[model samples]
Target: MPKMNIKKYTKNYFMPPKIDMSWAFKEYPDKAPVWCSVDLRDGNQALVIPMSLDEKIEFYKMLLKIGFKEIEVGFPAASETEYEFLRTLVERDLIPDDVTVQVLTQAREHIIKRTFEALDGVKNAIVHVYNSTSVAQREQVFKKSKDDIKKIAVNGAIMLKELTEKAGQKYRFEYSPESFTGTEIDYACEVCNDVLDIWQPTAERKAIINLPSTVQMSMAHVYATQIAYVSQHLKYRDNVVLSLHPHNDRGTGVADSEMGILAGADRIEGTLFGNGERTGNADIVTIAMNMAALGIDPQLDFSNMPEIINLYESVTRMHVYDRQPYSGSLVFAAFSGSHQDAIAKGMKWRAEKKPAHWTVPYLLIDPKDIGREYDGDVIRINSQSGKGGVGYIMEQKYGLDMPKKMREDFSYRIKDVSDHKHKELLPDEIYKIFHDVYVNVEKPLALIDFKLDKTADGMRNGTVHLYSGGKEKVLPAHGNGRLDAVSNALQKELGINYSNLIYSEHAMEIGSTSRAMAYIGITGKDGKTAWGAGMDTDIITASVKALISAVNRLQQ
Candidate 1:
């Protein structure tokens, strides 16, 4: 070979174009889907900070208010707390007339007996029993053969049939072949058939064969195929309410559940925000909301979804990820300039027409349906962001239009800051930075004097004076933060005491000069909690505005 210096040309990397989502316009039937919230059992068990009995009761009340017919309260056989919670519901007659409380148990005599003990006086209940039947689970976990597992499942079903009959209880029987997703189709069918034979479900009484994707280890389409196959081959197909429970190990729980529904599953088993063991179960909120958007009645009153999300987060101590499907903070939020423009236009379109049909350009579902206010400032400009986002924020915040030149200048500045700080710019914080860079405001509430001192005896003295409305108010008080000092000073000047006040702050931007937004929760003498919010370049000013807003709310 000749010694020739040859250079190879490199191919340029090109990003694929985005696909249009107009296919969602196809009409689908409006059948109401059944929803089962495993929050008490699955969600609480998965939480690092589990809900107390009182919190569980509060959540149960909320679920009832939301019109849930069936709620899996808890595994009563698991612990004394769970047992007592179930007992309290029964003793107090808290279970509503229409609603049914569901309890889970393994296919064991003692466990089922304990579950029955917990449900002694319940008006309506369902006992969900399950056992490992798959080859992997049977051979590995149970160390049992296929015939052995089937015999156990049949015996368990017969026992439940007799138990419910003897007690004269209005109970429904449900069985799950644990790890059915990986089980041999024929074996699973045989096990389920044997159980159905023992139970002998009538036309009115259908047994729910809950097939759970206990671990999401495969693609969504594969799970759907498995569900379709099982649904087609189940022995008593018409007498069975096919159910699905998918976990989110591979982050496709929602997709798996939805496809499973399409593949013939009638009931869903999941937790709010996908809380469960391992990577958590599928999120019922997301699945229900998605179905609602698809023109199917998901049978959930998510009108106060924000409150529900907040309560779940508070009680469970599990935050919903920003990118999580419908319930996420950023699901309806947009950051691209084009996306913001489209969403803004979509809101305007929705103002003129009913949103029954999915005709909005950018929004997949109406934000109003889920208690989210229309966001005009969905886009912003930064190093990685575009002019759409920045322009939206500018126009929405100050009613200022960004001229072509100003847009470019502000875009470059945002990009520079973003690159330097390595974080996205918040709309409010970006507004403040823009105000400092381009607009100037005279100090409205300038601090004149402030002092905090402690005596040798450990008594603390705090005083603050501020210039406001052309008057100087010097008031002495005692409290925590400088913002609290200022609030107390104002309270003293106004002759008001805001004793039940809680304040929280969030940095709106990154780095040293970032602005902060404050949220204040105030409890009135009338026993009402009012929320107020404020944003400012100075954290102290933000807190002051929030406090003032809280006071204003009290007046209202």
Candidate 2:
């Protein structure tokens, strides 16, 4: 083994917040923050294959359908295709009156003018301008001081204001201290206040002062503290919408956005599934769903989540991980034996008790609320399964009612094959296994013929014929019940002995014309148990066939 030096990296905390941030702990967002999706802009730019103009239009329609009143479309001046896309929206009058389109640009002169040109006839628009003010950018990238960076932001805000006045339009403005998390707190506040002075925001024309964790350099709590300091010190607090745009460098974009919201930030800007540059932006789906779970209306409609995921993946040329929160294929799936058992019991309890709230043990929210079913999605059967989950699936899928002990016995058979194959068994495969192994089977001891006659004491006398050793034999017997009477005839005729019969039955279909299924378990003289199932149009026949199947299994 070779030893290598590991002290090549160290912590660098460039920004220090001025406030103590005790108020962040005392308040949590009771309502959903104002949401702005930057999917078509920030998210699309990061894709290896960016969306075409037509695809961007399709995605924009989807966002509108999902109840987004404010959608940041794209940067018009960045590319000719982007410029055409915005022109198409305006020229064709595709934007709705309720929705406002926003476009992003830097603090440069020509870029800011061309960005407004794309929103020529828009009903409502936001001209979003940003500048890099972090210590690293000032030192290395731009080689400028704090005063020069402040000039960029102030001049951009003035240009936005002048353009709106010259065009005789009422377009809102947004300013971002691009790397807000890395910029010194007092300097960042001073620049934002200067922009606020230039824009002169009011209750009717609110300016968005977006604070972005562009490179997420610290913990979520630290970001929240920084947001709290800015929230307290910013000028014209009532007229400014403090927005948070968090990237996932530390894998805590969601945490930073949530904590920022708790610290008095009023808006959230991100992509649908956190699709953006580097580690990507905060996932708006997760943040919104979190709000919904907390009894707050997320304002956005995610009811048909599968449709949203399909469209997002199709347009973005990206694949959503199977384990992604709330929208993944396996988000609601429970694979562990203990988790499945608890969920099964909880479902039964909710059905019978009819509780007011969703209280499934392993589930945080009712999956059906998002269009997922419990049968296939919940209670997955594999090597790590138990009787409760198997029994639940059997009952839900095929309407089979197995006794508790028999269910336990059948679970082992299912797990045996699944473990041998090293895979999870689907519902149809499990059903076929049950049918082939236990259903009314006739083998070495096939039923030949039987005759029954009623007696005076409610007992039935029976005569049964069977071929045991390639020869036919006749025997007569009597017992208290029909099954018992048949059992007596089989024992007497075939010299087979068994006792302690347990039986259950249920209607496989709904009406009187429906077929019935019966399950039976019996113990033989060797102290071993056998199980069976049978289906017939008549209940009595089903029971008789079930007993015959159990006897054959015992013999084998």
Candidate 3:
């Protein structure tokens, strides 16, 4: 074997010019850039089965609801279905006045004419046109000169201007020098500025000059520099909305988009969950949420994120990665013991003080901010269980606040079960473990009946019927409290001696129920402790049941 000459195959990509790199040092975007979704076009094209007209409309409505003002619906001239979808929107008057439906086309006269025709009767539209001008695209694919490519873009702009005037539609214009990252910056600038010059954009009719990292070439910083240079040098700068269309070939699409925004791009073109050709586009969800985390309004609402993810998955037939930034099923979940403990304590602190910031450990925002509950979604239970998380689950889900030591004790039992079962436990299942093992246990010391009466001296008199030692015994005793009197009666009559009783109680605030829970712990003469839980409407009755549960476990 020839050792394959391992390093011979790869070559360095073309890097952009080394201009001033000041734009790369900004902290973060103070506001969201204008968001344009190409989900219906680029995203749909990538799907194995493109969305039907009905599904596309449903997804469009979702995007509208998410606050996207610009949507590239499809390449209307490419297919009848695409043309029909555009026609349906225009005829149905579904496009809102504030929203602009954009359509993509190559820099060809016939296709640009068909694109405008399909957009007939539309009140607001952005007719987007592009042609590849990268070195590889020009030399390998088109075999055309720079002058030839520039003429294609200039001609497309002229046709758009002529037809839009003829139709009197007042449509917006967007031009992309596709594969802009691979083209020489000076030449790319010349093409974009020429398009702008022909369009003669004004304040009333601003045009968009989109610089796509059609394929990411260099690192994020180099891309930012290129975007910064274009933003600085482009003619008709104020009337030009510099937009970015980044692809994830290098898995840095989001990073490129973020850097580009900082480098003076005014708008972002992406799809929900980054659904596009190749490795997919920059995920608009991530960009928006990242802005939100920094206290900047992302301008897009993802409050009902679960429903959004569900709808996107259903329509796109693409599964969102479980760790996808904000919309994933398990993005906020904590499974490690240390992680769970910090999150549990952080949540506790959040509740106690209602802090002005979201400082919950390992959590960027409240799960409730996205319609997720903290019970199962946040502090999950598994074999790696810790006291803080298990106890948090108990307190949040079922309202059973066990003592600290007892919580520590109970965590081990839950972990043992989870380790054996080889799976994570849901809230109800974890509660079931606590109920089955510790709550209201009655075996050898089953309480058949019990009554308590308060006397004038503030002492409690109690009567109990029990099944102990395989026989039923009746006993009577007195003490300072009802539960104490019951415990005394057991010790005196049944010779069961235990002391150091600990108790706590709380009402279950979840679901439709008036039930209360009581937790009791007792240490016997052997210094062995047993913990028990009971649920009932009456606190006293719940406590009595809990005491018996502890006693039964102690005897065993």
Candidate 4:
């Protein structure tokens, strides 16, 4: 064999610029988006730490509070736990009158019977039936012919229609061609038409043919084309509600759902925060917020999103990633210098105008809409960050007039640390790091000694001494708990009378022995608020330091 020399070659890659969504906004300008939560079904099934019945109930209530008119509670026939949850919902009359709960089941006799048993005595329900219709699904999963799947779907639809008619229940029927996105268009239409023929939904009671991208296999445009094709071809299309349920395997779930709507889908099935199997389903929060950005009200009441997020985090035990779209902690956070500068300017622009126009320099949607406070801390610096972030923090927190040189120096320091840490700095932590690096000073309040004692009668007492402002103050107090006693003693020494000051402490570093950070929110006598923080190896000391910081702020 002759020896051949191979030369290395590199090719330049160029991608198209992202399209302006103004056209979409203009085309679908007026119609209010329909939202359906698949939390109890899709979200529950996806969670590694599944919700208990009580947790499910709590989550269901939170969904209602968030103003979802339609919710898929669960596949009642799938498990006794699910059936019991549905039964509990019915028994307690927990579902809101206007809201409709949906139950999913295969097109089978026994499952449908169990589904009905679960829906017994429930008010306002939708019986969602589905069967695998794609060639791949039928051949791979069921090992059946297309005709067999069609018969099964038609039989299921007829059974549901008969059951609803005989029982005189106010229920709607919905059918999904499972894996419809991958199915042959003709076969999908055939199966959907067969089910529609059996149910024979009238114009007044239109059946919903929910086309789901069970596994997101292509781009959003492809899904839109599929949806449009189905909408155009389905028999008795006028008497049907075209619905879309898309998953997030490709990370295009939101775009796919929206494009499906544009392609004529009348309903959307998604989970809050896009919780589902694999990469999760479309996030209803992001979708609704997107609608709001288009000047269309999604008609959802997300006024208490923080509390809702807290509840969701607690029940699902799923941490909302800081970068997750709208609801994430860092969604509104700006770390880049240019971004922070633009946002700061935009905020000021909106503030100066009466009846401010929401369209501003950098904000896509107003933070206040989702009950988020506009704080500088959301913008921070790191290696990939810039000067705008540092300047914004300085002006907002310390009211410092940072010169350009100071900003450049700060930016360099931030970059140095960020490069070393290999991550962006949080706003609070950035300030702390900056203080430690540059503005090194003696401790403002030094904790000299503290002692906690509990009597045999279970009474708790503590004493705390601290040196601050050139004076050593000692105070003693009793409380129901050691931490409470310490807090009371500190309060007395500082003459700080705050109402309902709550202290939450959490470990910031890794491992059980790592130091912890304490966050303290104090409601002042004037009913306004301020937050203080401390860090220490001991949790109690950290909390005490945080409380002292709060008191010091009050004194200032």
Candidate 5:
């Protein structure tokens, strides 16, 4: 490996010197800002192969369904496909009355004219124009002076105003000082104010002054401070909609967006799942869902998260990572013993208390709110699982509330199986293990029949028939209850010595015809415990069978 020099790099971003830091005093946004999805343009262009026309339309329709009022359809002048997609939306009347479409263009005459030509019959549209304003772009890329770059932006804004007036259209205008993060904060604000002065926007017909962190180079707080400087110093401050378009070079796009909103930005332009240049754009799904988790209505519908993920992956050919926040497959899954235990207890508390708000531990919000189930999405079982998680599965799915000791014993057995198999145990597989190992063992001694009779003293007496080694024997005994009488008979006749028999029973379902299940645990002479279970329609018979099953387990 070659040694690297640390002296070669320098920070290119500049911070505002005289701005108030009041935006930092606020915690978070209490309401959602205006959301603008650039999925069709920004996200598509970065794909290995950009989306087909049909796929683009499908994606556009899904964006509308997700409650986005503003969608940047495409950069129509960039390609024939882009031009056709915009024309198709306008010609087929696919654009909704309440929605406004946005198109991107460079700060030049020919491209701007072609962009307007693509929006011939659109009722509501935003003509987005941009020019690079960062110091590196001026010195290295464009080789133009600061005044020259400012002239490009002012000319673009003048043409957007004149074109709207010439066509008798009430179209909106948006100006972006692209690469604003690497530019001087004061210079960026100056260019945006110049554009605003040309348009002379009113509150009813506002103009958007977008400051894009086109190549995020600093911490999130620096971006917020820059936004505050522009927001406080822009012309027509009340009428200008200050927008942010943050990319994720520093992996702080979402943080920049949230803090920027607190810094007085009014709108956000990004793509679904943050698909764009370099690392990606700001993930609108994450930003909106974060607001939802904070108990604020993001005004976006992401309830069916699975459906949204499916459509996004299908059209964009991008895989949503397994650990993606709130949208990934494993986001709600709990595999560790402690996490599963806490989640199981939290769910039980919710069922018992029915709280007005969601406060489950290890879970920020209910998975059901986003079309995921508790059983399928949460409380996953494996070798690392504990008693609470296994017990929760049994009680929630099978209605068998075993005692604490029995549950601990069962969990060990389950973990042993899972550890040896080196795999996760599904719910049905766990139930099968319980049924095969403990339920209804009719081995060396089998219970063929039993007859119960009440004595004059109110004591219960029973004759339990037992079969072993190809022989059958009927024994009579008396005790305070049927199960006790059966246990006494078995000990006396079969010489199966055990004591401290623990027993419990319940109906599997809530119906008169429901079958009953019973469990029994016995301590052998070696002081170890064995557990068993049985089921029948009659409660007393179920108890006798349970006793027999326990004795059989002890003999084994």
Candidate 6:
């Protein structure tokens, strides 16, 4: 391994002079910016195996369905597949009337001509031309002076105007100073202004000046300041769409995009999930969903997020990381005991109060809003789960609202099973554990039959047939109610005594059969409580069986 040397690296970015920091005072943008998806170009090119023409078409269709008004299909002049994809869209008339397709080309004349040819039959298109403008490119690669670089950009802009006039097509133009972050901020703006001077963009047909962090070289704030300087100094500002195309080399691509938008950039050019060269471009999904979280309509529809994820994964052969924000599989899952407990309580509050806005703890947005289920996505059960989470599963999935003390006891049993297995327990497995271990336990003490009748004084009279200790004994008892009457009979007949009997019952609505569910908790002589549950078609039978189950547990 080579020894790391910090002395060899110096900051390559230049801060714009007298940058207006006023843009930082506001919170996030109140409105959605113009979103331009560069997935088919930037994201696809970064893939190990680029998408085939058919896959590109499918991906483009999904982008359209997501409400993207501008989509950079590909760099047509760069490859045959890229050229054919654009031609196919034109021939099939797949481009919607409101959508404008964009193509990328170098400042070279041949590439620019081929790029325009690819968009020959398109109704609306953006001819995007870029030239490397960074100080590193000037000194190390091209060895060109400032004037020479400016001329190259100027000539490219003039050629685009000439071709549009010759073909009688009103194509909007866009110019990118590639690696703008590493370029002198003033020099980069000067080159862009020269290009705009030739295009003479009008309000009706506005041009785009995309400032890409082609290679991220500074903090997001520095990039925002650079964008602010360019936005202020640009010629024909009203007729230009100041755009951002930030890469994620420092993992701040989304931050740069956000701050740049706040700094006056009006459009964003990014790939889905931030897929691109090097680290990747800004993630459009994250940025747009961030707006949605802030109560701003992002103009894109991601309601069916799972379907979008499936298609993105299948087409790109890239897995969305399980921890990816908003769209990943586990982003909404709560497995920690504390997280699950809070989430469960928050859900209960939401149900009871029915709040107009989302305020669930630990959940930024409702999972149901993105086509995820509460039982499946949130409140996942594992050994780390606690009483509130386990209780929630029982109530939500099975309609068995166990008492609070019983819930704690049941949670221990579940945690033990999961800890031993070293795996997550599904809802059905959780219910199975509850049923097998705690429900209707028949053992040394069993209920053969029982009957209860009301007395003339409004007290309950009861008779229970018991089979215990290898003998069957018939006993009669009376108390305030049928359950109390049964409890008195059990203590007298079986020679067992306990106090503070806690019980609850509800209709089991989640199962196939119409059954009543009952839970019973009894405080033993030691003052510790044992819990058991029972289910039956009749409510009285369910409660009686529950008492017997609790007694069996307590005796054990």
**Estimated TM-score for each candidate:** 0.69, 0.96, 0.94, 0.70, 0.96, 0.97
Pairs clashing within candidate 6: none
Ten contiguous residues with the weakest lDDT in model 4: 9-18
Candidate 1 global CA lDDT score: 0.73
Q: List the residue pairs that clash in candidate 4.
A: none
Q: Give the winner by TM-score.
A: 6
Per residue, candidate 6 scores C-alpha lDDT tens digits across 1-556 of: 9889989999999999897788899988979999999999999989999999899999999999999999999999998999999999999999999999999988777887888889988999998988989989999999999898899899988988897798899999999999899999999999999999999989999999999999999999999999999999999999999999999999999999999999999999998888999999999999999999999999999989999999999999999999988989899988888898899999999999999999999999998887888998898888999998899988898888888888889899999999999999999999998998889988777888888899899999978987887688788978899889999998986688898889899888787457998999998999988887878888888898999999999999
Whose lDDT is greatest here?
Answer: 6
Candidate 5 lDDT, 201-241, residue by residue in tens? 99889999999999999999989999999988998999989
Positional deviation of residue 301's Cα in model 1 after best superposition, in angstroms: 2.0
**Residue 229: error of model 3 in Å?**
1.0
Model 6: residues with Cα > 4 Å off, grouped in runs = 1-3, 469-473
The sequence of per-residue lDDT tens digits that candidate 4 reaches over residues 403-499 is 4544666677788988998987766777776545333122565667678789888978867777867788777868787667867776676666886
Worst 10 residues of 5 by lDDT: 508-517
Q: Report the alpha-carbon TM-score of model 2 versus the true structure.
A: 0.96
How well does candidate 4 score on lDDT at residue 553? 54
For candidate 1, the per-residue lDDT at 211 reads 82
Q: Candidate 3 residues 514-541, lDDT tens each?
A: 8877888889999988888777788887
Native-to-model Cα distance after best TM-score fit, residue 140 in candidate 3, in Å: 1.0
How far out, in Å, is residue 244 in model 5? 0.9
Deviation from native of the Cα of residue 328 in model 2, angstroms: 1.3
Kindly provide the TM-score of model 5 when superposed on the true structure, using C-alpha atoms. Answer: 0.96
Model 5, residue 441: C-alpha shift (Å): 2.8
lDDT-sorted candidate list, best first: 6, 5, 3, 2, 4, 1
Tell me the whole-model lDDT of each prediction, alpha carbons only. 0.73, 0.87, 0.88, 0.77, 0.90, 0.91
